[model samples]
Target chain A: MIILTAAPHMAVWGKWLGDALGTNAAGAPAGNAVFGIFLSLLVYLIGQWLFKVGKGFFLFQPLFVGMVLGIFILFLMAKVFGTTTAEFYKSAYKPGGDIIFWFLNPATIAFAIPLYRRNDIVKRFWLEITLSLIIGLVVSLFFIYGAARLLGLNDIGIASMLPQAATTAIAMPIAAATGGNAAITAMACILNAVIIYALGGWLVKFFRLNNDPIGAGLGLGTAGHTVGSAKALQLGSIQESMASIAVVIISIVVDIVVPPFAAFMGLK
Target chain B: MASQDKVPQTETTEEKPSPIIVQMAIFAAVLFVSSLISPLFPPSFPVPTPVIGLIILYFLLASHIVKLRNVEKFGDFMISLIAFLFVPSGIQLAASLDILKAQGIQIVSVVLIATIVMLVVVAYTTAGMIWIRKHVFHRSVDVKS
Candidate 1:
């Protein structure tokens, strides 16, 4: 609304108020959580509306839409109100965004519910699921490292790329410890998520790999992480459960295996 | 008859938190515990707290300590809302656009290609393994029987 109205004056006043409250201080950490959440939600809704109206343009995934708009809004505000992007982000957005992000931790854990509910399928195909995930992990590592090397990425770059398919919690540290940039790994992880979410349905259609929910789930989870699992949930309950299982198992496998593998590859 | 029905309804209403609430509360508790324990691992250890929380939730459900019926609605709700929780991260991506632009081509291409390959390989491996187990190996036993 502020953006549409071009109310630079209102935005400036809000910044002044934030400053007055001393919530804008570095690391002391106080800001309007509600506004942050509302801002993201509004952007997401706009993204959804665009997708509905635009006939599903690939670039308009809600995540992409929200981030781009959020950035734009912040950048515009910084320009009008005479502040840095960093200052605006920290004071106006981080508190609420961080609060919501914390919920992602529990959300991941709550995955066990779907797994439990779908235990029959889980039990029946547990072995196949495990074997496929392990194979997929090994193969993906090979391809990621091989591709990075082929692209002339040095060892640190390969190490960062190696953990791209794993969950963020598991990927970031491994990237850092292996001499890769944490920021780069984080970016790679998010990119993996976006690519998978955007292309997953098309990939499934192109490959003619529909019908086996378990397979689809494992594939999505192995490659996509939380974003992939979110997509899987939209597919069906069984896919959701299987994807959750895949995510948990893959995270464990990557944590145990990637460190040793990184060492052998001379990452350290 | 009306009086008797009213008394029973009142008693049931006063009994405890709704099952969905209990389920959600348990999830929150497990998440809290997981966060508490995450820092104890070596600094290099990837805090596997989410997985740990999943394990705890599984046990609670399996043992009937947290009844499935009580929590299923809330769990489903959480699953549906998972993507919404990611909005902040997506927004946070804006902060790193400069870095993204610098290595964008390499990063995006590798992610795109690797993700596609990984998905295909995993789907095929899983589907193939299931087919082998069900048809080739299990068929032999069925024939023997």
Candidate 2:
């Protein structure tokens, strides 16, 4: 059949394309930084396009889709190169991944614009906002500590979860500094954002938060970071601004408070 | 009073975004200063450089030292790409499959329960405070358009 004949040709084409992109026949690392950047950008674009095509389905969230697709492609490349995914990532993907990752710092600084633009609202409600965040932070720390301990996690696990509410850029460093695994912290941060983005609307309705944009925004931003802010933006302009405020304030509070909290909890 | 009077005039004249190159330069300068200042803090309570940069940039914008128009376009562009910027770090999960294989269920459960509880607690506490202020204090806490 024509289909049967084309399958082998397709496989050959894939290998040839992979080889040309830097994977060699000897099964060595790709050693191509540009390929990593290109793959990230291309996969993200595909994910964005698919999100649009899917009519804004939650599961089709661009970040989630792009990550899954990107990982799957990397897994395939690792197989073709006869190496582990971790090795392939370090040798090939990391060079370019690090480049993209560097932008996160500046991107975080860009948050200042929104904070400044909404300064009036922030000023008017500063007390309310700060108090809510502090209360939330205190409760969250205790909950994380108690839950982790009750579940028999070690100090490292407790330490990592302590900073889980902060954005990854801030959370990872705090986790590492407090003797926790940065990778685990990052996973927790991303998972929190994904969970909030997926269930935020339902949570709002269930909690009767539809009328409280400020509360909704603060909760979303404090718990979910940037993705939560994106969801806040969908709710309204006020929600978006409040979410941004929460993101900034929560990060600062977490930076200042998490270390001592971890130490007080007897975490190394 | 004279400086205060000049604010509106300058705002009126410079309505358009500054050149992209100028915006980049401002960001570079702020980030450079942030990196220099970051190490001064004690190692035990490390403040990330970006957080310092964020505080610096906020002060700059607040004082009108850096006009909103100077960085608005580029800032928005950067923020929009935040989720994209995080993809690399997220992909690092590939390297941690071993840990995931061992304690993944516990980790997931802990994160799931804690996040939900935190969200509910934060939202209600905030909303309750706002409601009390509006109803009890009779303050005009209406959302501004």
Candidate 3:
């Protein structure tokens, strides 16, 4: 809404995916959280529609189902536009696939509230949070380095991929500095999010573990960023609070530890 | 009287603090102050502001300076935005495809192993902490003469 209404041109710089996708009839109205919110809502609506009316494959996730419809639209429009369609999304798909990380910053800050509520739980379980972070840091780095070496990865690959589990905006730059792969960093970030979401809760439950807010929040937040904390929150408000705190603590610690540790271990 | 009355009065007294907004303000403050000069009243590493903010909030809640429910509202809001914040990471995947293609198999293998190790280690430690807290921290009340 803001960009579309106030300054339309700024959309090009936001994210490459949106830019490419925009060339058609359906570029984002504006490049902001509101738009993301709308996109998310659209996904939900499509999901419900597919769940109700669609058959076979499309009957599953509405957002994904909607995305398929949008793709078909793209194919149709391409056929209609012919040569002109090729030029349409050039700006959108330009080298970066048309995406920028606009909304993630707020989501990161939003974690503080959960962290706040579970401070005592953290204090009570300080040992657990600290230990979990230290162990996670050591283990993640060690395995990444050891596996890389055994697989005969070059120094650059080892360095770059080491910090992918941290946040992207921060990790991309770090990967660049260390001669690591930024793309790998990106994959690691997403992969880590997936891991955190899937296992973060069950792992805790599996152990029938006890945690206060800080310990739980710190553990999840640091290991997986915002997504990790989100999983922690599902455990309860107490875990959410601690996990938020942990995300910050762990991001900083891992940020420091990852490069040095990787270089030390990988000998790059 | 003071403890009971004060607790009830405060609980009933005011409009609930919007946890999300308040936390945002605090996060901004932490980010800013951290950039300039972060004080270490409580021990920490790398970024001191988060720890300081964590401790300050902790004190406020524990000492009854702030209500838990109010704090909870803010905490829950952060959890809601987790996936949205991570969308950027997903976007970066396109950028990584080149690197991934070049070293895809090797890199992914390492990542897989690392992730598994982290999950196991953290889980083990967490379970241990729970064990200690339950058994060591609590004294049995049973008395037999």
**Winner by DockQ:** 2
Query: Which residue runs does candidate 2 get wrong by more than 4 Å?
Result: A1-31, B1-13, B131-139
* Tens-place lDDT digits, model 1, residues A1-268: 2221343466566546555433345554444576677787888889788878878776776666766787788777655645666566766676777787777676767667767866766666667777888777787777777887777666666777777666665566667766776546655666667787788988877887666666888888888887778788877866777787787677767766677678777776
In model 2, residue pairs whose N, Cα or C atoms come closer than 3 Å (at least 3 residues apart or on different chains), thus clashing, are: none
| Candidate 2 local lDDT, A117-210, one digit each (tens) | 8899987898899888888888878887888888877787778788888878888888989998887888788788878888887887888875
Computed on alpha carbons, the lDDT of every model, listed in order, comes to: 0.70, 0.81, 0.53
TM-score (C-alpha) between model 2 and the true structure: 0.86
Top-lDDT candidate index? 2
Reference contacts preserved by each model? 0.60, 0.65, 0.30
Q: Which is the winner by TM-score between candidate 1 and candidate 3?
A: 1
Please list all clashing residue pairs in model 1, or write none if there are none. none
Which is better, 1 or 2, measured by DockQ?
A: 2
Report the candidate with higher TM-score, 2 versus 3.
2
Q: Interface Cα RMSD per model, in Å? A: 3.7, 1.6, 6.9
